[model samples]
Target chain A: MAKGLDIGTMNIICSEREEEDVVFTQQRNAFLELDSSDLTETMLDSAKVLYIERDERIYVLGEDAFKFATIFGKDARRPMRYGIISPKEKDAIPMIKLIVERVLGEPGYRNEVLCISSPGEPIDLDMNPLYHKKMMEALARRMAYETHVIDEGLGVIYSELSDYNFTGLGISMGAGLTNVTLAYLATPVMSFSIGRGGDWIDEQVSITTGLPKEHVCATKEKGFKLGLEVEYGSADGALSIYYDALMTYVIKNLNRKLAEVTPPKVEFPVALAGGSTLPDGFLKMFERKLREAELQIDISKIRLAKEPLYSVARGCLIAARTHEGEEIGSGGETEEGAG
Target chain B: MDNTSSPGILQRGALIYYVGSVTFAAGIALLAVGTAFITISRIHYGSEPEKIILSVISTGVGTTLILTGINMMMKQTRYGYYIVGASAFISLLALLIFTSNYPHNWFYPLISYVLTLYIAGFLALLGNAFANVILWMIEGKPEAVVGREREIKIYTDEEIERDIEEATRKSIELSASELKFKEPGVEEVKLGKTFRETRGNITKVKDDIGEAKSLRKTINPGERMKSGSVEVESVSRNLGEILRKGAVQKGRFGKIKEEIKDEMKKFYSSIRVTRNR
Candidate 1:
């Protein structure tokens, strides 16, 4: 499998003090070079492990695993969901498993200790072992049946949240789910993601349009904004229905969360992340909806994370790092010499 | 007529002429140097007259050598098989004449020893000329300048010297085209392609004649002027009747004499230039 892909939901978070955003670079347009961290290690003796966090799944790899998927991992354009996998978490395992195989290039350089990411707080007190098990079983299968196996817990770590010294809410608004994580101490404290993201919006659009889900998905990227302010009864009438449905749902969710919650209140500013939030005027739409719901926050406080496309991976990097920023493996400090 | 039009042969002559002139000047100096030795040999030892004579001798030798060396280096160039051959012949002749003229004191040695050496050198040069000619005949080198003379010839005037240039230009076109066609597998004939194509009415008439012959052959001859195989008697043809013809109706002899007698006429000469190979 060459650079397999994962698909997930994307959402935009609008709050009272923050206008939703995704800050990629700074006031200066200059962008720093993207690090080849996923594929490299600082020291030769240190074993390299790459962690990829996608909307639906998390990919973990070691050694030249990232390079194994080099062909499919063409940065020229990262495949959001361009292949066999639907816009879902199942995509990530195959994506990373293929990535590992691709990087190694030679045969027999593969190892199969599998893991996948779960939602922030699991919403339910009980762990749904069945659902996670199914996802991991599928992940292991994608790895073509190797030995070792494991499950990684959903991470809420420090030092990985805000590389820019930002202390705001970081949201992974994906296609079928929404996750919000706050950063202070350079890492996210509480993060929660559920099935209420871009895919849901597209689904509503599709239900109204009687079109396929894929069509609705494409329309969100391009046709979503073009349908606004125009009469709803045009040929885009059904799509408008999906649009209204998403807007209403997003508003309700924001209102319920913000109005109901008190002490564990979010930080003043909030940053939006994820691929689904890439349309024009998306922030304004969220803001207007938030204001109408009487749940508006500081519009100026919002910022968009850089490469909303790679927030999870970046956050995963931060989460995967040790106190010294040198990433610690699953083995404790005692095994530091082993790697 | 060709002689009048293009001074092609003349230009080639001019090139050789220039070279010969320079060589001639140098040979004169060399001869003078040789003569100085004579003066030096007659001088008295330790006398002031000996010093003066020695200086004179030195001047003579120095002047001759400098001039001769310069001339040889300038135009001992490789022209073409034909032209080089001609120049080589001329040089040998000049060498003989120049070497023959000194007093017996110097002349005997120059004639016997030096002249023998010259003959051998001349034979070697002739061998070079023969080989070059053979090479051109078999596998021609486009660098050969012999053919280019026709072009140079046309550039000179016979009638009005200015008009002569057009003739020279035309000649180059002709010669260049001729070579190009004869050189099978060639695609371009440089200036010659245009000239071959612009033959005007001459080619048109030829084409017409061909078409007419083919058309006439399609008809059986029996239907025309067949006075059925009558007499085999030979009759005296009337030369007087032919002589009574108009000015334009003259026979071939008249046409031959129409231009300068005995000279083959042409509107132009041929010359070709190629990048130095």
Candidate 2:
């Protein structure tokens, strides 16, 4: 059996193939610490809030954390920032492990292959994702599964660009970082992360508006759209402003990064994925930016993934399927080492 | 006309321009008030030389901000970012000066510290706002800045070899764990359901282990020779026989080793090492 796990900064999603259809399970990668009290515990239990009690502190986990943070006007603590395990969050490891287990469930069988999406090396930040990837691999191993680490952007390609012979540009505008991959025949020619994404927008909006990061995040996720005029002082306005800036930054870097490489002479089809791209008019805004960028390479088309939020997980499943096939063909010995 | 500067782009750019202008005005107003406060206090209180020096410095900074703001508004160059950065630095300096000089009394320092913080906060906000606006305005404009290369990890040959060796070792371990033996013609029909391993797996495992052991011996024969003279003599004798065999003709064994070496180099060079992490 094969499974795909997209360990995103904002959400952890798992994909499992059941015959012809693929099913997905997701959990918000966030938590909130509330005061420990019997009444609070009773209230949380009555509300059915997903939480854990440790050392006399009630830590609300997953989607409920966002709700509680918004209620309390506090920022939801993230287990990951900028597409890796957050150094700022003290309980990132245990929290993320619990969240992953909740979302991924148990492996179908022992040594079931689990392909996890990991962000590529960042271009704009001095961060090493190896530690994050290894931690995730170890977590998967401890759960009694073989793990494969695939590039986040490459996962988008596998999910959305099969018609292009897996040759195209995949951009995952995730919460923590925008991962970009230019692939040919399912092989990544170039891949890197921009170190800024939805979280950056939330932080920027929070700083500008004096709103808690969670409040800004809620506003952004609550029916926000790009290319629409909003009140300049409002949270949605700030979100839109930063979203524009983020798209421009991504395009500029894409142009510059693409210039450095000698890519195959093909009209590349670009596919966009991730939660950040789910906002209305996002594709149109991104297309506008791409047109303005006047990139040196030919772009055949710009398309959004059918399900941007699940694309990475689905792509991971595709990869895991192929990897499992290869392992079977090789008599249970894969060329790639266990990650 | 080029689509790069369409009405939509211009409208967006214009909005940012106005925002930048407003932020610049607010920053200049704060700096102007700060400069006026310093001047008024220095003159009314007949301040010390240090106070006079600070007043002059504040005047210079206030003037610089106005001039830079005007210059940036006109030119919209990369220097706009530098101006905002310099303003921020000046704000920080003013805060440090105010706090250190007025250390004796909390009441006096608190008021000035709050004012400085307000100025610093405005400057920081302005810096961010200006950076975004300036970046938007300068879209697609190329600059020959150095060291902007993507930080993709390029592994050295040694690192690549180490990774391959690690993978091979894991493959060997997997082979060992999943190994199965079959006796020819002994319940051959029943073997179909229970034979979890393939015949080729055994052969491949044997070949890989034998090759690895031989390579290890060839690379570090001295380690084995250190144990005892008898072992050393045996290794020397084996080496002599191999040398004699190779001397007679370019044997398949020697050719295979050379081919493996060549293949290793090719593999190392062909693999594009993008994933360093």
Candidate 3:
């Protein structure tokens, strides 16, 4: 079976269709480093946690790294920053490669089809998405997979807007960047990104509230909700305020960009997907912001993805399946037999 | 080519001509005076020794001036007339002064000076006129004009129509050849058809997948997370509990702090941190 991968800033998720179900495997795309010693190595060996040993030192990886960082009062480091490989991290590529390998595992067959979701080029940052796309494709190819890169926002459309003929706007509120795609009849007409997302909100809230970034991130992930009105006295409240600001900025830019194009004469539903959109009442806040901005397009509805965090991976799986089917058909094989 | 427009060259030539005329006039006056001096010396002094020397000197001076005047009249040298003119004028003055004060008294000297001056002036004028004539002949020729206008040729209607028809025919032929050159080959036709079909198939498949997604209910991430059994759930819960307890137990800050510390110890033991750089 083909696999779909979402190499997100926060997590690396691999999805595969097993029978009638979609199964996902994920690894935290983060790490923490510590001075190496005999005792430390023994402790790490005994704990059996995911780690990499390099240059006479050890790197604690995955979700456990953050736990260790909190105890040590040190910040957990991410291999990815702002949705691409962190340029400052010396071991970013190697660490990401290890995580991707663990999450995707070995291909079931040689040259197995794999569709990877890649973020659109950022409009507000000098980051090159092409390098990231090529790197991920190279990684997947190394694992014996025939890889394809899909736009992160378009992947959201493939996952959530199948009923709309893929003609709506898809916004993936990821941790490092908010990817926006406007599609018409399954074709992407415009795709761009703003370099602000969950991480930015957490960072702003952390700074404003004088709390550790880890604590802020933990608070946000632990079922925090943003309402029409926020309580300014609490950390969650601070986070909510920032979330609103981010939504407002995104909407304003979206409207400005949309104004430049001649939109098709069809109503489009705005679909929000990604880890940042997991907060409660996020759909309502987004809808309110869009209405307040008075965008030019006819938005039918604003709905959240059933599973925001896995939508990109699921969309990638869908694309991979379709691609596999096409390959089979072109090779003179029966589609039903291939399925 | 117009003499009036280029005054510099013409002005120099005219001045030279005037100088030559003056030289010629002065030479004739000197020759006349020398002849009169010799005739008076012979008639009145009977060729006395002192008078003979004076007559010979006067004749030699007159002969030199006449030769200079003839040379200045030629156009062989540039500014040659100025030399001749100055010499002739000086000699005429000298002769007039010498004859006026010496053996010949005021009457003979006065008569000789007046006749020589008048004759010199007249000959200079005549030479100047001839110089001008020569200059005009050399400079006023029509063929010497530097720039000349060319005649424009006009075509007949028949010729113009024939040229237009020829150009149109050539252009039509070129267009026909270009069209033939750009005609699609068999391979190109097949390639284009395959490309279109592939594009259509891709669109169809995308639509099919989108339709399929729309029919499904909202995907529950909680269910998927539970199935994956990721370590984030435990970490998030533990961290959340500590933060929540810390916020709630503000009055027992010390106890909450100890509890947090204890919890961190337990969590850190299960994980490992290292510096890999």
Candidate 4:
């Protein structure tokens, strides 16, 4: 069986097909560090915490880390920041490996195909995605899976645009980044990402309102409506303000980038996916922003993925399945490598 | 037209005028012959003066056709074919009238009408051909402009082989350089610890802790008091030293607890800022 992995900032999800069923397994991609000591070890051991030891330090990982942090009245730290491996986190690689391993488990067979989703180069940030992509590929390869890298936005297209013959615009509003891809007939013509997304909105709202980032995050996730006027004092109001700004910024950049390339003259249905797009009224707000921006392309419709958070993983699974078929048909000689 | 000029370059206007002049001269000759025949018949056979006038009218109509053709050719008019058609019609009408007058000898008028028709048709065709030629001349031939030619060096077979060999050599060198630029794979990456083993260990520790707590809760107070008295009797010999040591240990424990409480307070305060907000 082939696998699809989405190494998202907030969560890491792996998808595999079991007969006619598509199974998804997820783990929070966060951790908390504790100074190593006999008492601490004993306490953690007694509590049955999932952790790793590096440099004589014990690090609690995944959802358990968040639970421990909440109990201890501290914040859980992320191994990935802004949709890539955190350069500031000393244990980022090991932590990611642990999370990925748990989610993917042992490969069903040697050289099992695993297509991993990678974000496009951000237009607003001076960050190179090569290191993160290579690290993930290396980790998956170490586990004996022949890996392929696919753009996160294109993954959404693969999952959602099958009805359109993969001709559409796919936008994945993830936690740390928003990826946009314009694909025609299953081929991507243009793909890019912006550095602003759910996390950026949370951070901005937190700063503007003097609230904790977690509180803003919780409020946003708890169904704060956008594209409506709201009083300006509350956390939800601040979140709504930033959400509007983020959407406008995304639309403006999409327009500018689209102007640079000539795409085929066909109506493109825009599909929105990922965690940030899951809130109520997000698609409506996005549509409003899109109309206000007056983009220079025909948009047939604006759609939301049925399961926004799982779309990338599901699309990656579809891609892996396609690659597996090609390999089998070609007698395993031609391997689809990363672009 | 100048004799030195190529016939291909002759202006269509001049050619039309030349054809028109020839047709006019032929029409005048025909008119003069018809007029003379009418005058001779009137003088020798005492033909009617009205017949002579009719012949004169025919001559006048022929003169009008010739003049119309000349005007069309001179003006380079597109309506030149109408002149030729009118000429043919007038000639046929004149022949019909002449035959009705001389029913016994129709051959002469018939031949003249036939000749007139032939001349009219020829003029029409010539006018059409002239118009086409004028159009073609006005739409001049495309001129071929020769810009500076690139110097193409023709290589001998030996030279071609040498160049190919040189290109192959350069490609090999390029590949070698590319290999040098290739990045090395990561070698020291370490995987983190598994969740299941840690969970198992924690479960065992939890069970042990639970058992210890339950056992402590279930112990009887009377048995505990008896054990405490026995323990006190056993430690009575070094009770003063033990008491001093216990006092020092309690003070140290207090300091450590205070520090831990302060640290916990800091951690809680850092994460609980949302409450203040």
Q: Can you give the TM-score per candidate against the true fold? A: 0.32, 0.54, 0.54, 0.55
lDDT of 3 by residue, B1-277 (tens): 1234233122223444455567667767767877898777563455564675467456645655655555444442233345446545655565555555554554675657755754564465345435544554566643212122324589778658856955784476445432211212322111111211111000001122333323221221121111113433565577778789889878988987887776665554433221112
Over the full model, what C-alpha lDDT does candidate 3 score relative to the true structure?
0.70
Compute fnat per model.
0.00, 0.00, 0.02, 0.05
lDDT of 3 at A26: 73
Q: Write the per-residue lDDT of candidate 1 for residues A191-303, one digit (tens) a residue.
A: 44444566566666666657666455555666456336656544255555554566567556554544423323444455565656566555666556655665533323555
Predicted candidate 1 versus true structure: per-residue lDDT over B1-277, tens digit per residue:
1232222111234464356456556656656765666575554444454444444434433343343333332222334334444545544554444435533344565556645644454454545545544554454344342433434333224336534644674465445432211112533211211222221111000111111111122222222221112211111122223334434465565643544221211211111111111
What TM-score does chain B get in every candidate? 0.23, 0.24, 0.25, 0.25
Model 4, CA-based lDDT: 0.70
Which runs of model 2 end up more than 4 angstroms from their true locations?
A326-339, B1-277
> Model 3: what TM-score?
0.54
Candidate 2 chain A weakest ten by summed lDDT: A330-339
Interface Cα RMSD of candidate 3: 25.9
Top TM-score hit:
4
Between candidates 1 and 2, which one is better according to TM-score? 2
Candidate 3: regions farther than 4 A off: A326-339, B1-277
lDDT of 4 by residue, A29-139 (tens): 988887777787778777767776656777888778877887777888899987999998876886788788878888999999999999897889989676787778878
